[model samples]
Target: MQDTASQATRKVRAAGLRPTRQRVALAGLLFAKGDRHLSAEELHEEAVDAGVPVSLATVYNTLHQFTEAGMLRILAVEGSKTYFDTNTSDHHHYFIEGENTVVDIPSGPVTVHNLPEPPEGMEIANVDIVVRLRPKRR
Candidate 1:
């Protein structure tokens, strides 16, 4: 069986990324826990906890690079908050309001209907639906 680092290295290479030490370390943390959402700050903390010795800027850069390379997907839930999703498949998400977290809503559960045509010379490139959820008040 391939180790996590090996798999990550292979994945990065396959995605046309350099697979540097920092990228590999971050990839391990991102992919090891399976499909989930994470932010650069959260991932930087994890890297520190794992003793990866990476800077926060490096984490942010690596994440953007990974997303561009099709290794991950970016979820912009709010103007100030952004998340990195390991699951790149066509699916929606549920944003927990107070908790500031996101969870998958499963692809088939939500269906978009009657999307308006894109402006002239432009095209619609997929839609991202974020269903906001919060605790019910009594």
Candidate 2:
């Protein structure tokens, strides 16, 4: 691992993650873009293109573990496969329908005006607000 990513791995290990080679490589790929969203397939393809020496299965497992560890947010796009978001802060996303791309929307002072309350026993784990949008036709 490089010096910069060694520090990153240390931080992730501090958060109770093992920081395995696969996990560290995946983390580096995710953080390399400086805040972006990518699907598992997309990431796997990128890794292969860059010759990162990781398998697709490892990508999926690392994604799941990283998500469970709160390192990334899982974006469940209705009627589509899930996307992994690099931004960890409280925010929403915009799904471009035909593009199959997700974009983060600023959640500043955004409050849910009308929403049903959660069930008595189950607590709110996440609030996924996705805006499916279409490009303006000429």
- Predicted structure with the largest lDDT when compared to the true one: 1
TM-score of the candidate numbered 1? 0.95
Output the worst ten-in-a-row residue range by lDDT, candidate 2.
107-116
Give a tens-digit lDDT track for model 2, residues 26-49.
787788668899999999998888
lDDT of 1 by residue, 65-91 (tens): 999999899999978899999999988
Go through the candidates in order and give each one's C-alpha lDDT: 0.92, 0.84
Question: TM-scores for all candidates?
Answer: 0.95, 0.89
> What lDDT is reached at residue 115 by model 2?
67
Predicted structure with the largest TM-score when compared to the true one: 1
Question: What's the residue-level lDDT of 118 in candidate 1?
Answer: 92
Model 2: lDDT of residue 87: 86
